[model samples]
Target chain A: MITLAVDCMGGDHGPDVTLAACRQFLNHHPEARLLLVGRPERLQGFAHERAEVVPASEVVGMDEPVEAALRRKKDSSMRVAILQVKEGRAQAAVSAGNTGALMAIARYLLKTLDGIDRPAIATQIPNMRGGATTVLDLGANVDCTAEHLLQFAIMGSALVSVLNDDPQPRVGLLNVGEEAIKGSEEIKRAGELLRAAAARGDICFHGNVEGNDIFKGAADIVVCDGFVGNVALKTIEGLASMIGGFLKEEFSRNLLTRAAAVVSYPVLAALKRRMDHRRYNGAALLGLRGLVFKSHGSADALAFEQALNRAYDAARNNLLERVRTRVAHAAVLPAAPDMASVPGATPPSPH
Target chain B: MITLAVDCMGGDHGPDVTLAACRQFLNHHPEARLLLVGRPERLQGFAHERAEVVPASEVVGMDEPVEAALRRKKDSSMRVAILQVKEGRAQAAVSAGNTGALMAIARYLLKTLDGIDRPAIATQIPNMRGGATTVLDLGANVDCTAEHLLQFAIMGSALVSVLNDDPQPRVGLLNVGEEAIKGSEEIKRAGELLRAAAARGDICFHGNVEGNDIFKGAADIVVCDGFVGNVALKTIEGLASMIGGFLKEEFSRNLLTRAAAVVSYPVLAALKRRMDHRRYNGAALLGLRGLVFKSHGSADALAFEQALNRAYDAARNNLLERVRTRVAHAAVLPAAPDMASVPGATPPSPH
Candidate 1:
């Protein structure tokens, strides 16, 4: 049976959402067991045949500084859940806590895989093709070198391969323009690195793609630094929500339009289901030594369940082994000199 | 009466769209005159009392490099249109040609205003509040320093003030996060410069805003580096189109949905009208000594006419004079140390 560690005292709703999600998740996956990490009193009376509470005294507030959470809260639920992954007590860990604190503790406790400079957050976004496009470095490392991007591409490719069952998933480097000469120097250098890696049969690089290409499903996987990815992701969310609001207002404009809304209810409902971001929750923190998935901090019970199911699937599919093997193969290739000389070139120390 | 220079042989449809737009634009504004610049052979037989064909020998291809179009094609229609603005033959110049080529020529000929290091591209985007937000540095100056962003904020605020009739428009610096400690070193430093400018009463700074805030109408003016701004703008365009395609597919699904589509046609049309990007055409190239506006390369006759109307309005309202006055006032503030040391800190060499 695959086991998953849950940060029960995390996210906006905390135990209210996480615990309810756990109940639903358990009903769906009979073979999966949960190691619920949180304060004993908060998680009390959670009686499931496959579930056990791992009590922790502290909880990391969503707005707390990463340093304070990391240094001061040693026994915090978020950290303890991640520790379960480090100790092999669980195959994967899931959290909807403070992203900064979660990433810091995961990096410090689980550490990064060999040949990976920094772990990147990868999440799925809805695309025009009806399927989803996986985008990486959501908000983990802000200032990334070309080498870090290359690593993200490799890791992202591996994740997509396992999830989509595509042997050679297409990888596109996100830039301002599709042309090679369009973006900043770092992006140009990363393009060269990605091309070289593609030559080694590491990935199928689909050249450069613009921001819109992400939603157009131009490539199976889109790679970018955290800053750009974060901004792009949030922009998509905002635009989608705004469009939704406009649609509602338009439908309710008058009696005729309101009646029209009723006649077209199924079409609108289907559209809503297709565009619902909650279905695509759970961003994987790839390149880590252990498996970790982060759900949105404000995720509802249904969304939290999706995150839990994603973690269970990753653990069952041996995603950690797959990432390790691909990264090992990629590391054997000759490193580009320009990528090696980037200022923050220190290798990540493995825990 | 205001005379506007038009690049007739620009954009994908060339004279087909521009000439038709000119005919319609002239009908709407009786006091306005157009100096249509293009090859004589292509401009033949188009006669209007308010429109005069100014012969040009060459045309810049949509995909031509900036250097080739600037130096090699000196007599290009795009160049001749801007030449009219520089020579005081027209109050403003409008082009639907190659953006890179147009910006390079405009900068080379008209140059920048006093104390402005780089000219930025500013365009209006529909917001949730039924109004539009002005975003600057759409794709002109990619690698921007803190000082360049400060100039963009001042210029964007000035544009919004004239266009939206808000004397003190709120300006927001776009970043990955709203927190002061978030984003790259350059963005953090830019925040300081923006805050200092706000203190000096140069602008009504709204502090840092995320990408979603652009659509949420959090501020009247959003300032960002060209790279990020371009990416965000294109991403929004791509998403809007994708959403459009999705809605069409949903409404046309089978016979029942198709029947419902007919009933809901009015609501859909209203939504489409509100979300129509064509209504928001014409990106102003700000900080130039002479006024210049860019139409999308693929704009149709109606869209191109909207750009012409925008140019006419700017000229009629004396946007250039307003921008000049605001920038001059901002230059008197004590410049931040970090902004002062940015590379390429030389004062603009005005025409």
Candidate 2:
């Protein structure tokens, strides 16, 4: 059975969405089993023979402090859920609760990968391209150096390889330009280190990609500091919402436009499904010793189901081991300066 | 006549798109005067009398170092065009040249405002609301502190008021959450400072906004550091391209889908126009002592025309003066802090 731990009391929608999602996951994957950790009352209604309820009366609210909240609420559903992963009681953990809380408990419980100083929250973002781009450290580490960014690249590369099933994932350093000297002193230095590593022919290094490349999948793995990653993630979110708003305005502009949407409904529906956050809900807290997925707080059942799929894939792939091995190997290896000549480095380093 | 300087020797597309854009601008706005700056030999044939030729024998290529190119090539179109802005020969300068060169010149000539450490490239990004959202620091300072972010918030708000004609345009700190405490320590510090500023009514503050807010037009102005801003900008570019790819793939799915696109062309056209970067080509170097505009390096003639309009607006509105006046006023005569809550604790503290 693909066992998963569910943070039943996490998220804005809380138990309602979590319960529905668990049921949905079970329905879709008969092999999937859940250890629902939350207030028994919340996880009680939909008691499945295959799903067991772990009593946890507390939760860290969306607004609570990360450190204090985690410490104060030892029995909080989010923490209890993480503990399941810590104890190896479940292969993966999923939470839609406070992200800070999730990250903290996951770190405190599961511990960081052997050499990782920090564990980054790895999430799939809708890129300017057709596929979702994986950007890490979206929140986990606020202040990061070049060495940390290098580790993120290694872990991210491994995650992308497993998730996308790409034998050699192309990794790009997220920056303002493709030029080596572009950005801050740190980013410039990071670029050099990344190039040095890429030269060894260990991982695919696609050089520098800008914000536009995030969505374009210019590289399977885009690494940056948390601040930039957070901004990029939000920017993509802002753009998606902006486009959604425009479509709504356009379709509502006139009866003709609305009629046009009906005729184009199939294509539009397909497009929406292709871009839907629900279909791409789970974000991996990469570099962790175990798998922990942070779902959007407002995620509905469909999104939760998607999270389950991601968790399952993650568990089956032994993602943690892959990341751990790659990171360990990358840490000791010499720099690969030769990857600068990656076939696609010219006018369009758009990422 | 509205005289606008065009850097014919700039951008990947160079004079081909640059000349076409200039001629088109002149054709559309007969009263508008065009000063094409480039190699006299290359520009003389295409520009004729409608657009006067400004002899610039050298050009800045995409591959060359921005500073090196600017320093070595005294007669380069990029330098000459910016020089025109400095000399007051042109009300505004337009360049598809090196962004680094334009920013350097603009900063060196225009100088930053008294309280402004760095000027930012502010652009109106297309949102889902069918209207545009103004995001700043598209490419300006690569590294910024919390204090710098505060300045961006202030400047971004003023730009929105002038550009969108909104009364006290709501300003949001681009972050991963709507909560005041949802980002890096820097962002949190910035958020606290923003909250404090908002309490004092410095500018309309709307707490934190996520990436989706960019498209949703959640706020009139979204403020961030240059590093984050660059990532966000490129990410949006990536998303736009990705959507284009998705549409292309979806429409090519089958013969029936192709036929449907024919019927759906009008709606698609309207949506595409709303999202087009050409309409928002002009990027004002905000916080500068004087007004400066940066066009897309690959900008065609249509894009150049839009840039001209942005420049004219900045010039006519005395945008630089307005920003200066507002900052001077806000910084001066410190308004009473939010003393309504506490009578004992003084607000005067150290940064």
Candidate 3:
């Protein structure tokens, strides 16, 4: 039986919404068990047949610093959820909590693979083709060296291999243009690394892709620095919201537009479904020692249930295990940072 | 009488499309005169009654380097068009041909206005409310400093004031978020500079705005590095294309949807007109000592005509003179760049 650990004290809805989702997921997967980590009293009212409570006394607010949260709130449910995966008690962990906290805890507790510097968070986003494209480092390591980007490419490509049975997942470096000469120093260097890696037959790197290329499905996986990745991800969400509001505003403008709106309701519904923000839930924190997923902070119970199902798949697939084996064998591990350098270290470049 | 310089060899469609647009524009405004600059023989057959042929011996292909094109193709129509603006023979110059060549020749011939380091291109894009917002530095500059961004804000604000009739144009620095601190080093620095500039009551700098904020008309002018600005512009255009394609695809899915599409045709038509790309044809290259405009390379005759009309407006408004006075009174001129450090200099940053 698979045991999925969850952080009940994370996200906007926190314990209540997360608890409801846990119950619903348990109902669906009768053989699955949950290790719900949070304050025992706060979770006392929730009763589920296949779930057990893990006593964690503290909570990390959405605004708390990731490292500070992990340090000061040692007993926080967020850290406990990830700790379950590290200690061999659970196969996978999921949280709709603070993303930075999940990543810090995952990397610190579970540890990175032999050749990985900083792990990345990879998510599948809806595309125009009704299919989805994978994007990595949505908020993992904001300052990445070219070499770190190379590792991200390898790890992200591995996730794509697991997601789609497509042979040799096509990879692309996210850039302002398709040219090799475009983008900043970091991106230009990363492009050369990816090109060299693609030639080596590790992954099919598909050259540079622009912001517009994401929706066009130019490649299977798009890799970027967490800063650019975060901006692109949020931009997509914000655009969907803007489009939704416009459609609603237009559809309600007097009798003529109203009549058109009624006739087009079914078509609009289908399009909206294809564009729904709730459909894609779990983003895996790749390159760590064990499985960890980050869900949306604003998610409700339904979205949380979707995350639970994702946790099950992530556990079954053994994503982190595959990443470790592939990266460890294909690339040489650079010397680890000294203890002093670790604290002030930004992500090293793949260059 | 308004004398507008037309680059007959400037656009993708070349002489044929330009000739048709000039003829149509002349029908609307009898006082308008076009000094159509290109190969005289090539344009002989298509010349309009109100247009006179100006001889030019060369053409700059879209792929040519900016500097080489200016030097080698000095006799080209694109160069001649700018010369018209510089020599005061024509009030304004318009081109739909090569962007780099146009900018190269314009800058080299007309030079920079007092206190401006780099000029920027501003496009009037359709917003959610059926109106438009002016976005700047579309592709004119790639790398930018904080001070350069401040200049863009001022120039974009001035354009909106003259063209958009917004007396106090609210400027927003395009960032990942609205928080002053939530952006890259350049944006963060630009924020402080903008705030200081705004405090003086010269221009209203609203603060940091995100990509989502563009279509929502969150600010009258959206400013950023040329690289980000270019990507954002293309991304928005790409989304419009995807949404349009999706709408059409869904409308043809089944008999029910087809019938609904028919019923909704009029409404869709109205919306399409309001969002029509042709209506917003010309993008002004701001911060120049002379008036210059770039039309869409793929623009049709109607769109091309609008480009000419836009040039007419800029010349009539005395854009260069106004910009000089504005900077002289309220804006600070940045120090000239130290030529030693310049390598593959993208756009100069507004610092």
Candidate 4:
């Protein structure tokens, strides 16, 4: 049976949203088991044959400082959930808690894989091709060198390969333009490194792609530093939210428009389904020694269940082994500082 | 009278679009006069009392290399249009031509303004507050220092002040988070510089904002390096296009959906008109000695006319003087190398 650890007392809704999702997730995946980690009082009511409650004393606040969560909240539900993965009791762990705190705890517990300097957040954004394009470093490692970018590309490739079941997924270096000479010096150098990796058969480099290319489905995987990736991701969220608000206002302005909205409900619903964020809720924290998935902090039960589904799939597919294999094959990666030895390394910024 | 030069032979539609836009623009603004620059053969057929034909021997192709457009096409329509502005015959210039070529030619001819290291493209994105937020460095300087970012904030303030008539526009430094400690070193330094500028009463600083803040209308102006700005801009375009395509597909799937589309036509049209990119076509190339506005290459007559309207507005409101006043008053800006003396400066990449 595939086992997953759940941070039950996490996210905006805490036990209310996560417990409901866990019950639904357990019902759907018959061969899967869950270790529900949270305050014993909160999770006592959630009892399932395939699920067991793992007691934790504290909960990480949505706006808690990373340092405080990492150093002070040693018994946080977020940490206890990841500890399951480190202890080999669970194949994967999923959380909807403070992103920075989660990443720090995951890194501290699982450490990073060999040849991987930083663990990146990989998520999917729906594209025009009726499929989602995988993008990496969504909000981890804000300042990245060319080597870091190259590593992101490799990690993204491995993740996409498993998600799409494609042995060789195409990777695109996110840049200002398609030309090699375009973008910052770091991006240009990353492009050269990616091309070299392609020559060595470590990745299938699709050259440089613009931000719009992420939605255009220009490549299966698009990689960039955390800052740009975060901006692009949030920009998409903002525009989509604006469009939603505009549609609602337009359809409710008058009696005639209200009737029109009723008539157009089916088409509008289809559009909404196509662009639903919940369907793409899970964000994999790749390059860590253990698999961890993050759900949006404000996710409902349905979205939280999607995150559980992703972690389950990643575990079953042996995603960590795939990443290790890809990183090992690519000999261009430079040696990185031992993160475990650096006690005061900068904490990751929240997504 | 507000006199503007038109690159009539530029963009994909060339005279077919620009000439038609010129005629319509003249009818709308009685006080505006246009200097239409293009080959004589194309200009001979059109005549207007307020608009004069200026002869240019060549046109810059959209995909032509920046170096070729700069060195080989001296008398190109794009060049002639800017020449009118340089010669004091016109207050501003408008083009729907090759972006990189236009920027290179404009910079080489007009030179950078004192205290400005690079020219940036500033444009508006529709925001949730039923207005628009002005963003700068859309696709100019790929790499930017804290000083360059501060310069962009000042330049953006001047542009928005003219566009909105707000004497003190609030400027936000775009970053991953609103927290002061959240982004890259450059972004952090930029935040500090912006705060310093605010203390000196040079700008109204709104602290750090995320990409969503652009649409949230959290600030009147948002500043970032060109790479991030370009990515944000193109990502918006791509998503908008995708949504448009999806709506069309959903509304045409079957007879039932088709009837529903007919019923919802008015509401749908309202949404389309609100989000139409044509209304926001003109992007001002700021930090130049003279005002130059860029329209989308594929713009139709209506969109091209909007570009003319922007240039006229900027000229009439004395945008250059406002920029000069802001830059001169700000004591933090470091002196830039004389662009005129740098004979072999790198050409701008295409927007």
Candidate 5:
């Protein structure tokens, strides 16, 4: 059975959202089991043959600082959930809690894989090809070197390979332009490194791609530093919400327009389902020795269940072993040159 | 009367688009005159009392390398057009040519303003508030210092004040999150500098804004390094196109969907017109001694006309003088220590 640890007392809704998602998840995956870790009293109502309640004393706040959550809240639900993965009791762990604290605790307990300096956050954004494109370093390292970028490309390749069953995924280095001479020095150098790795058969690099290329589906995997990736992700969310609002206003302009909206309801619903980001909720914290997936903090039952599904799939597919194999083959990720000195390069909390 | 120099032989469509735009622009604004710079033969067919064709010996290819275009194309139309601004023959210059070449020639001829280290590209993106958010460093300085960001905010404030008539336009530093300690060291330092400037009554700082804030209209002016800014701009373009394509597909899915589309045509058309990026085509090259505007290379007649209109408005309102006044009042722009030493920090080409 593919068993996963759940941080039940996490995210904005805490036990309310988590418990509902766990019950639904249990009904769908017959071969999957869960170790629900949270305050015993909070999870007592959630009883299933495939699920068991594990006790924890504290809960990490949505706005808690990473240092405080890691150093002070040693027995927090977030930490105990990851401990299940470290102890080999569960194949993977899932959380909807604070991202920075989760990454710090996961790194501290499980440690990073060999040849990987820092773990990166990877998520998929829906693209025009009726498929989703995986983007990495979503909000991890703020300032990354070329080597760090190269490592992200390799790790991302493994994630996509296991998730999509595509052995060789095309990796694109995110840049201002596609030209060889474009972007910051680190990006250009990363392009060169990616090309070299591609030559060695460690990856399938598609050269440089612009932000629009992410939605254009020009590459299967697009890698960027955390700051740019976060901005791009947020920009997409902002634009999508604005468009949704505009569509709603247009549909209810008057009695005549309201009739037209009723007629077009089927088409609109199909379009909405195709572009729904909730279907793509899970984000992998790759490069760590153990597999961990993060759900959006404000996710509802459906979205939280999607995260659980992704973690279950990653574990069953042996995603950790795939990443290790890719890293061992690349042999290019040199320990980031004193990661401590890179100002603001520490693991950052996600908004 | 305002006279603006035009690079008539620029962009992908060259004279076909630029000449048509100039005609419509002249008819709309009798107070505006154009000094069309290109091969005289290409512009000879057009005749207007307010427009005159100036001869040029060369043209800059859209995909030409920056160095080749800057060094080899001396008498290029792009150069002759800027020469009009430098020689005091026109109040401003407009081009839909290679961005890197345009920036190189504009900076080389006009020079940066006092206390300004580099010139930035500022453009407007339509927001939900029935207004547009002005974003800067679109594709000028790829690698920016904290001081460069501060200067961008000051210059962007000037652009908005003259164009939007908002004397104290709120400036937001683009980052991963809204919190003060959320981004890179340079971004953190830029936030401090902006806050200090706000304390001095030089600018109205809005703390930190994420990428979505540009579409949300959270701030009047959003400042970011060129790399991130360029990506945000392209990301919007890509996603908008994808949505447009999807709408077209859905409306033609079947006879029933087609009938619904016909009934809903008016509402859809209004939404399309509102979100049309062409209405916001003109991007001002800020921080230069002279006013220069850039149009999208692929812009058709209507979009090109909007760019010309923006340039006329900027020139009539004395955009250059406004920027100069703001910089003088701030007294915070320190000369960059060594721009040459920063790798890939040179002026970059826009896609």
Candidate 6:
């Protein structure tokens, strides 16, 4: 049976939403087993044939500092869950707790894979082709170098290849414009490295793509520094929310519009279903030795279940092994020429 | 009567769309006159009492390098149009041409205003509150320092104060997170500068805002480096387009859905009208000695006319003088203590 570790006390709703989601997730995946990590008092009575409770003494607050959480909360649910992966008790770990603490603990415990400098958060976003595009570095490693971007591209391409079942996924470098000369020096240098990597047949680099290309299905996998990717992702969420508000306001404008809304209920419902972000929950923290998935902090039962399913799929597909092999191959490629010596090349620093 | 210079040979559609827009614009604004600058052969037979054709020998190709367009194409229509503004023959200049060429020429001719180090491209975006937020540095200067962001805030606030008629427009510095410690060092330093500027009554600083805040109506003016701003703006455009394509596909799914679409036509029409980007076509290039507005390259006649209307409004409202006054006032604020000595400060380089 495939086992997964759950941070039962994480997220805004805590054990209530998580426990309910675990129940639903267990029902759907007959071969799946779960280790629920949280305070014993808070997780009382959660008994099941396929599930076991791992006792923990503390919970990571959503707004807690990474240092405090890492140093003070030794027995926190988030760290305990990640320990399951480290100890081989579970194939993967999932959390919706404080992102900073989660990354810190994951990096400290599981450690990064050989040849990988840092891990990236990869998630799926809906695209125009009725399929989803996998984007990486969602919010980890805010400032990244060309080398980091090259690593992200290799990792993202591997993820998409397995998830989408495409052997040679198209990898796109996100920039201000499609032209090679359009973005900052870091992006331009990253583009050069990606091009070289493409030459070695590591990935099918589709050249530079603008932000809009993420949703336009211009490429199967889009790679960017965490800052740009995070901003782009949140901007999409905000715009979608604003559009939803606009639709509601217009549909209730008058009696005639109200009747039209009734007639269009089915169509609108389908659109909402297609655009629902819950279906795409769970961002994989790739480049680490073990698999870890992060769900949105505000995720409800249904959304949490989706994240569980995503983790299960990654484990079953041998995603970690795929990343390991791809990264190993990437290490063999000749290092890209030093960009620092190139005029105007601004080497990125960590945030 | 207010006079506007028109780069009649700019953009993808060229003089055909621009001249037609001028005809319609003149009909709406009886007090407005147009000076059409382009090749005289291409401008033959245009005989409107309020419109006059200024002969020009060359046109800047959309793909031409900015250097070539600036130095080689000295007598180009785009340059001639800006010359009208510089020579005091026109109150404003409008172009639908290449953005890079236009900005380079405008900056070269008009120069930046006193106390302003760089000009910013500011445009309006629809928000959930049924109003628009002004976002600046769309694609002008990619890498921006804290000082540059502070300047953008002051200039954006001044523009909004005049256009929105609000004495104190909330100015937000766009970042990855709302927390003070969330983004890169440059963003944090920029936040400090913004707070100090706010203390001096230079702007109504709303503190750090995330990408979603741009559409959440969280602030009246959103200030960001051009790289982030451009990416965010284009991402919005792309998502909107993808959603539009999705609606069309769903509404035409089958016979039943098609019939429902007809019944819901009015509601959909209202939604489309509210979301139409054409209504917000013009982007003001602020901080220049003379006023200049840029329309989208693919703008149709109606959209071009909207840009013309925007230019007229800015000229009437004295946007240039307002920016000048605010910038001058900003010059006296004690220069933010040099942050270079601060640990973890990444000094931003001009891109």
**Candidate that would win on DockQ:** 5
Q: Tens-digit lDDT track for model 3 on A1-351?
A: 999999998889888899989988988998899999999998888787778999999988876665588688888898899899989999998988777677777777888777777788888877777777898877555446777788888898878777776658888887766767766666787888888877777779899887777778889898886656765676566556666676777677889889989989999998877777677788878888888888888888888888888778767776666777668655653443332133322221110
lDDT of 1: 0.87
| TM-score ranking of the models | 5, 4, 1, 6, 3, 2
lDDT of 1 by residue, B127-187 (tens): 9999999998887766677888998998898788888888999999887777777777778
Query: Which runs in model 1 stand beyond 4 Å of their true positions?
Result: A332-351, B332-351
For model 3, residues B1-351, the per-residue Cα lDDT tens digits are 889999988777898898889888888888888898999888888646778888889988866665678778779889998898899989889998778678778888998877788888898877776677788877677667888888888888888878876777999998755656455566677898889888887689988877667778888898876766766666566666777778888889999999989988777776677668899999998888888999998888999999998888777777667667666655554554522124434432111
- Per-residue CA lDDT of model 5 for B1-351, tens digit only, reads 999999999889999999999999999998999999999999999999999998998999998887788899899999999999999999999999989889988988899899898899999999999899999999899888999999999999999998789899999999987779888998999999999999999999999999889988999999999999998899988888888888889889999999999999988987898899899998999999998999999989899899899999999999999999999999756656647446576566554
- Per-candidate Cα RMSD to the true structure, in Å, reads 4.1, 8.3, 4.0, 2.0, 1.3, 4.6
List residue ranges in candidate 6 displaced over 4 A: A332-351, B333-351
Better of 3 and 6 by lDDT: 6
On the 0 to 100 scale, the lDDT of residue B312 in model 4 is: 94
Highest lDDT among the candidates is held by which one? 5
- lDDT (tens digit, per residue) of candidate 2 on B1-351: 557777888777887887877776667766667678888888878835657888888887756665566468778887787777677777677887777767766666666688776677788877655578888766566665677777787788777777877758888887766765455566777887777778777788888877677777788788876677767776677777787788878877888778778877777788888788999888887877666788887676788778877876766666767788767755742222222122211111000
Q: Pairing residues by index, what is the TM-score of model 2?
A: 0.86
Supply DockQ values for each candidate. Answer: 0.47, 0.37, 0.32, 0.61, 0.76, 0.46
Distance from true location, Cα of A51 in model 4, Å: 0.7
* Complex DockQ, candidate 2: 0.37
lDDT of 2 at B118: 66
Instruction: Assess candidate 3 and give its TM-score to the true structure.
Output: 0.89
List of chain A TM-scores, every candidate: 0.94, 0.91, 0.92, 0.97, 0.97, 0.93
Q: Across residues A41-108, which tens digit of lDDT does each residue of candidate 6 receive?
A: 87778878999999989999988877788899999999999999999999999998887788878988
Runs of candidate 3 with Cα error greater than 4 angstroms are: A64-72, A104-112, A139-145, A333-351, B29-31, B45-50, B65-68, B330-343, B346-351
Docking class of 1: acceptable
Which ranking of candidates, highest DockQ first? 5, 4, 1, 6, 2, 3
When summed lDDT is taken over every stretch of 10 residues in candidate 2 chain A, the lowest stretch is A342-351
Check candidate 4 and list the clashing pairs.
none
Which candidate, 3 or 6, has the higher TM-score?
6
Model 1 chain A, poorest ten-residue lDDT window?
Answer: A342-351
Superior candidate under DockQ, 2 versus 6 = 6
lDDT of 6 by residue, B17-106 (tens): 998999999999999899989999888778899999988899998778777998999999999999999999999999998888888889
